[model samples]
Target: METETRDITITDIRKLLDEVTDPEIPVISIHDLGVLRDVRKEGDTFVITITPTYSGCPAMDMITLNIHGKLRAHHIPHFKVETQLAPAWTTDWMTDEGKRKLKEFGITPPMGSKGSEDLINRHPPCPFCNSENTELVSAFGSTACKALFRCRDCSEPFDYFKCH
Candidate 1:
């Protein structure tokens, strides 16, 4: 008897997912956000794990569709994407690399320790100038995903991912 092998690998999934940029920030990928939890082969298909940036984030739909669409285009047959919120995704989960990409894309990423209590703290330095002279303009930004803020030193408005 002969056994069948699969070409669907995590690398393939990651590569395909690399094509999935955050809808809000096209330069940064969802994987960069620490969103792509796990990609592994399971039987004849693949299994992907993801965590939502927030509980009510509407982008979840787009994310799922993106995974399916891209993988399907690559001729990937069957797969399952499991969403886990146990360690609910937070801005703090955003990696250093992700931050750099955000800055390069003209969007200021969130500052230190993303926690509910921490969001109200006024001491986070401006990601643009590394200055402590920044103020929160509003509690919301482009989407429920972010907040509006202005840097006192740079005098520029920026978005801060709501650390939910």
Candidate 2:
């Protein structure tokens, strides 16, 4: 079975891509996570731009593969997945829905925008118990972009998606 590509619009492509979730954080789609930047049709090719949460993020490879798989599955024959690193990715780009999803998934989302002064001394509340009494267990969590934090009240360990 093939999807009718001739009538497909950029909006249609975006809807399809919304189904693609991040490999590391499955609760949020790439678009909400602020990874999927743009989707536009140029000539006959659809160009999809994505930015990594960080430059050296390991999930980029899997993300690209997933994007390709998604487009191919929808019979989108001509498309380009480009990784744009310039200007860099910031926590501010993440959607509010994405943050809520992250909390529901037991991970603390970045509380402030990247380079914000509050973020310098801020402690992320526990997603499970919403306690401000949290201690940094480790600067690095399961992934480089997250930090391991232990909630004093809940006594639960959670990963905080670091700002920037």
- Best lDDT among the predictions, by candidate number: 2
TM-score of 1: 0.84
Per-residue lDDT of candidate 2, residues 16-113 (tens digit)? 99999989999999999999999988887899999988777889999999999998988888899998987788989999999999999999998766
- Compose the digit string of candidate 1's lDDT tens values, residues 126-155: 667877787888887888777777888989
lDDT, candidates in the order shown: 0.75, 0.88
What TM-score goes with each of the models? 0.84, 0.93
Q: How accurate is candidate 2 locally (lDDT)?
A: 0.88
lDDT of 2 at 129: 86
Q: Score candidate 1 by lDDT.
A: 0.75
